[model samples]
Target: MNKDIYFEDVNIGDSIPTLVKEPVTKLQFVKYAGASGDFNPLHTDDDIGKMAGIGGVIAHGMLIMGFVGQAVTNWIPKKNLKKLNVRFAGMTKPGDTISVTGKVVDKNAENNIITCEVFAKDQNEQVKIQGSFEAKLPKKN
Candidate 1:
């Protein structure tokens, strides 16, 4: 995919390929609950979710973050990863189409790190996470 984006192939203004994920649902919330060992009622019980002042069973923030992380790793590959950081900003409801996007913000060939600004947006164009990532790409010849 994308010829493995070598250090010599990208620039600060280059747009990273955007990845759109399927709409989030209760079933996915359940699966993520089991996989992460975080069966919080707020994520599974519609009643509990409402009582907590949130809409029915909001999606887990971690799960959404993971989706964004997947988009970056899938694009650049694991060998290039150096660091990733994100801040949760909004909640996602069922049936929302989550989109993950990123852009190459800076690149350092001497240290082999490519910095990118990453974000996950919902159907309403609301940001879920404001994040940044750094990956060490294959060195230029």
Candidate 2:
């Protein structure tokens, strides 16, 4: 079970625990396609990808966003999240190692909310997705 993160325990600039995912794989993409019902060829068909201009199959943007979401919920319980958003900045291909990191950017003690700036980057430090989130936290007694 996830413990409640008290608002008093977090400070601006505090780093959230990082979540590093294993390298992207074709099988994962296929599974994601089935699970999401997004049968886009660019995500599951390499030959189609080559024809479309991208060199090979690319992972779905939502899949990468899911990774970012995991990073947030890992630190803040799912029920606490009030807002979560991301922008896809780059394509993620098979073999790319994704690392998600975040830092506390703002905290409203009166509102019991914490805002964070979060991003996902590949092995080369190329950002694939960037976003922010707000979560309600308990107050320490």
Candidate 3:
């Protein structure tokens, strides 16, 4: 929302600003559970996670998706987002640092829309989520 990004200024391979999230933490999972009403013990209780054979508590997929959403909205205004979709690719554990990135994949000059391929990867280069989005940008005057 800082400035309008005109469609004419962006190329098919242009990179969007990256968003880096703080390390994942137990407290964040608890907070997300409270906010999202996803009280699944696998995300909140280590013992339950261990019992379920996951080794330890895992971060909620939706929470990671929220991080990806933040990345999208940080580059384009939320109101201009026409489509945003993601596939949960892997589990995120506490202390994992996530970075969200995107590249322009396609565009529609007539409709002023830009399509982007987006993803969230950890410090170790493990992909946690992969997705794409479409946003409407202003036409150059």
Clashing pairs in 3: none
**Model 2: which residue pairs collide?**
none
Ranking by TM-score: 2, 3, 1
lDDT of 3 by residue, 1-141 (tens): 657778888899999999999999999999999999999999999999999998999999999999989988888888889999999999999999999999999999889999999999999999999999999998768
TM-score of each: 0.95, 0.97, 0.97
Q: In what order do the candidates fall by lDDT, top score first?
A: 2, 3, 1
Q: Residue 73 deviation, candidate 3, in Å?
A: 0.8
Tell me the lDDT of candidate 2: 0.94
lDDT of 2 by residue, 7-47 (tens): 99999999999999999999999999999999999999999
* Clash count, candidate 3: 0
List the candidate 1 regions with Cα displacement exceeding 4 Å: none
- How many pairs collide in each candidate, listed in order? 0, 0, 0
**Local distance difference test scores for all models:** 0.89, 0.94, 0.94
Worst 10 residues of 1 by lDDT: 1-10
